[model samples]
Target: MILSGTYGELRSNHFHSGLDIKTQQREGLPVYASADGHVSRINVQHYGYGKALYLLHPNGYTTVYAHLQNFAGEIQKHVKETQYKQETFEIELFPEAALLPVKKGELIGYSGNTGSSGGPHLHFEIRDSSQRPMNPMLFGMDVPDKKTPIVSSVFAYPLGADAHINQSQKLTKLRLIKQMDGTYKTEDVISYGKIGIGVSAYDQLDGAYNKNGVYSINTALNNTPKFEVKFDKFSFSETRYLNRYTDYGYYKTNRSKIQKLFRESNNPLSIITNEDDNGFIHVQDSLDYSYTISVKDYKGNDQTVIIPIKGTKSEILNPRAIEETEDFIYSDHATSLTKGKFSVYIPANSIYEDIYLNIKADGDTLIFHEDVVPIHKNITISADISNYLEEDKDKLFLGRLNYKGKPYYTKTSRKGNKLIAYVRLFGDYAVVSDTVEPVIKPMNFSEGKWISSQKELKIKITDELSGISSYRATINGKFILMEYNYKNDVLTYDFGDAINTETENNLKLIVIDNVGNSATFEAKFFRK
Candidate 1:
C-alpha cells in the first residue's frame, strides 16, 4: 500500500521514519499485511510507534505497521510468550524467518494511537532489504486526494548583521490574504536588505479531518525555480535541526512549523534543491518582482501561492530611535540552578522570537507556552557547587535526576560559564550525558552460576545519563545477537545454532554506553 505521508521535514531525532496512516480518527481498525512475508521484528515502545510489527516480504522489501493496538492471534501469542518469559512491559524481538509467516491481505494488527502519537492513527512504511526506509506511496496504496495545501502564515527574516526588513533590522510576519480565485496575495509589499522567507502550511486528505504535513515545496523567482525541496525521505540522524529549518522563535511561541523554502548556509538538511548567496530578493529602484511557491503531496495534489514585491530603496531607521527599553526581573521562585551544566534565563521582554522552554527544580518540570519577544526573558542555571558539594561530591554520584523519568547526569565542577539550564521560548533543551556508563544487571543468571534450562539468556540494562548505546553477545566466544528493548531495559538472546549440546557454555555480554563506556559480564550455562 502506498504511504499517506511524505518524507523530509524536521522531526524528532530522525525524519518521519515512515508513512503515518490515518485510521479514520479511531482505533481498532483492521490492518492488512501488504505482502507475503514472515514476522521478522516486533517492537513495543512507550513513546514511538507503540506496538509496531515488521513483515519481511519475499520481494526484498519490508513493510512496517505501527501504532497498533493488538496483533493477530498467533502473533499475539508469540508476543505474550516473549513478554512473559522476559517479564517486561516493552520488548523488541526478532524471530527466525520461519517462526511466524504471513500472507498478503492477512490481518496482522489493529490500528491505534499508542506511542508519541497525538491521536489515533497507524504509521506505516516500506524499506528495502538493507532496512533503509523508502516512500510507501511508490507501491500503489491508494489515497484519494485532490485538494491543494493551505498556507497558514508567511514570515520574512533578516539574516546577518546590518541586514534589515523594510530598512529595519528586525524579522516580520507578513499579512497574506486569499483571493476569490483561490490564490494568496500579501497585504503589504516587503522591502528587505537581506533576508529569507519561511512558510507555515499543512495538508489534509479529501475525507479526513486530520491536518498533516506537506510532501514537497518549491520556491521560484521570476519563474526560474530558485529552490525546490521534496519531503520524500530523511534520516533520524538530522531531525533535531528542525529548529534551523523554521522560524525557531515563531514556532516556540506560535505553535506552528514554518518550512524554510530558502536554505541558510549553516542549515544541515540534505533536501535543499536551490541556493542563493543572498536569500532575500532585492527589488531595484521602483522595481516590481514576482515570487511563487508551489506545494504538493504524495498523490500529486498542488497549490501555488504568488507574492508580488514592490521594492523601493529607503534609508534605514536609527537603532536608538526604535529601541524599546525594558527591564528583566527574576522572581524568588522562578529560577532553578544546576551546576556543571548549561543554563539559560530569559528576562521579561527580552526575546522577539517564540521559544520552547523547560523550567524545573527538585524533579518538577513545566513547559511554558511560546512567549513573544517583549514579554519573556531567558535565564541560565549556573550554580557554584564547589562551595556546596565540595571536592568529594564528584564521587557521590546522583541517581536518576528525574524530569519526567528522563535522567540527566549531574556533576559538580567549576568550568567556564557554568550555566547548566536555560529557559528559552522554543525547541527542546533537555540535559543528557554521553560520559556515563549504562547499568547492566543479570536477571536470569548470577555472576557465577548456571542459568535455567529455558533455552534463552536475559539481562536488564539501564542508563541514567544518555541511555544504552549498543551491545554485543558471545556464546563460547562466538558473536550472537541480543535484542535491546529500551522501554523495559531488557536484553535477550535466543538459543540458536551458536549454542549446542555442551557440558558448560561461557555466555559473555559486553554492553557499550552512549558515551562509549563498556561493561562486560560472563556466566557459565548448559543447554541440552
Candidate 2:
C-alpha cells in the first residue's frame, strides 16, 4: 500500500480526488476489489482518470479504481463491445445494481499509466452513499508513517482595505524558526485591523520522504478556535472551489499554493466544517495577540506554529499602490462590457469579490485583465468578425495569449457576426484565424505497405496552432480504437480487433483542429 498521492491533496483548481497507490513505477499490477460490491459505473476517456471503475458496496460506500491497463475478461469484453457498437473511444456506463457483483479481493483490473496520470499508479477512492469522496486513510488502509508534518513557511495577510501588516498593505512573508521543543515560532509581526494567516506546508511519511498533503489545519487566536479544516470528506461539485480556498492569484504567479487560514466570501469548499466570522481576527488597540496554527497528518503526527502579533496602529511606510482603472465591475450582478469591436459578459458570482477591471483595447486585441483576481466561472467574450472575408469567417475564432505569448483557443461559438468565446482565464484576447489544417504523419507504415508482422500502428498528429480537437480512424470502414497520447502528439492502434479479414485493407483517418480545419489520411495495406 505505497502511496504516491494522499487523499485531499491540493491540486491545480481541484483537490486530489483519491489516494494514488504506487505500483513501483510499473503497470499491469493486479487490482482487487476492496470489499463485496457491485460494479456501479465504468468510464473510458482520453484524459483525466482514463480507464476507471466504480463499485458500490452494501455498506453504502463506493470504491473507485482509476488509470487501469485492462479490466477483467468479462468487463473488457463488455467495454470493447460497447465501444464498437457506439463507434467511439470514450464511453461512460452505469449498470444495474446486480449486473456485475463481486466479492472482496476479486481481481477487477490491472493498474496502468493512462489518461492524465503522471506515472503508473492506481488512483483509488472511497466515497459515501451520496458520491462524496472520503479520505481513504480513515478507512483503515495502512501505510507506514513516523515523520511529523513539516511547517516550512508562513505568511501574514491583511484581511480588509484598512488592514495593514507591518505597516504595509501587501502581504508579508514570515520566517519561522524551529525551537528547542520541536515547535515552530514566527517573529512578531506588528499589525493592525483585520488580519488572517496562511501556510505553505506539507506532510512526510515514514521510510519515504515524499511530501504529501496535511490531514487537518486548526487556526486559533488568543487560544480560542477560529476554524478547523478537516479533509476527512468532500463533495465533487465543490472540488473546483479549491482555487478560491487558497490564494489563487498568488498561485498563478508562484507555482505553490498558500493555503489561507481564513475563508473567502465566494469559496464554497466543504472542508472547513467550523468557522468563526470567516476565520478573521480583529485587532483594534495596541496590544499583543497570540496566533496559533496546528497542522497534522492522518497518522496524528502534528506540528504547531505560534506567532505573537502586536496590534499596533502603525503608519504605512511602503504601501503597495493600487492600480487605477476606469472599469469597475461589482461582483453581485452580471456585468457587460463593450470596448470598440469586443464585448464581454461577466456572469453574476463569477468573481470572488468586487474588483477594478484594468481593461483596454489595442486594435483587434482586447486586454481584459492581468489574470490577478480569482474568477469562479467562465466569462463570455464576443468579438466582431464581420470584417473578415466570407471564406475566412469560419476560421476566425477567439484566442487568449498565455504568459508565454502563445495563443490558445478559447471555446468559441459563432453568432450572426461575432465569435463568442467562453474563457475561464483572464488575459489578452484577440480574434485569431486558423486556416491551416492539422498535419498527420504516419510513423510506422506507408501507403501500399505489407505489415503483417506489425503488432500496432502509430501516427504523429501535430497542429502547429490552435491544437487538435478530435480524431478518428477506421479500417475497412469500421471504427478502430486508437489511443491518443496528447503529451507526444502520438496516436497508437493495436491491430487485433478492427483488422480486416480480407487480404487487402484500406485505412482512413481524419483529424480536426480547434477552428474546424481538418486533414485526412488514406492508405492501403496487406494484413497477411
Error of 1 at 389 (Å): 9.6
* Candidate 2 C-alpha lDDT tens digits along 1-528: 678789899987789978988888999999999999899999998799999999999999999999998788667888888887887878999988877888999999999988899989999999999999999988898988878898878998887777898888888999898899999999888898988899988988765666789999998888999988999999988898887888888888887789998887877778998899999888776788898999999889989999989988878886767776888888989999898899989999898888889887887899989876777788988988778888888887788887776788788889889899888778899888899999999999889988989889999999977888899999899789888888688998888774567879888999999988999999998877
> Using lDDT as the measure, which candidate wins?
2
The segments of candidate 2 whose C-alpha lies over 4 angstroms from its true place after superposition are 207-209
For model 1, what is the error of residue 274's alpha carbon versus the real structure, in angstroms, after optimal superposition?
A: 4.1
Clashing pairs in 2: none
For each candidate, how many residue pairs have backbone atoms clashing (under 3 Å)?
40, 0
Each candidate structure's TM-score, on Cα atoms with residue i matched to residue i, is 0.62, 0.96
Off by over 4 Å in 1: 1-14, 24-26, 188-192, 274-286, 318-528
lDDT of 2 at 147: 81
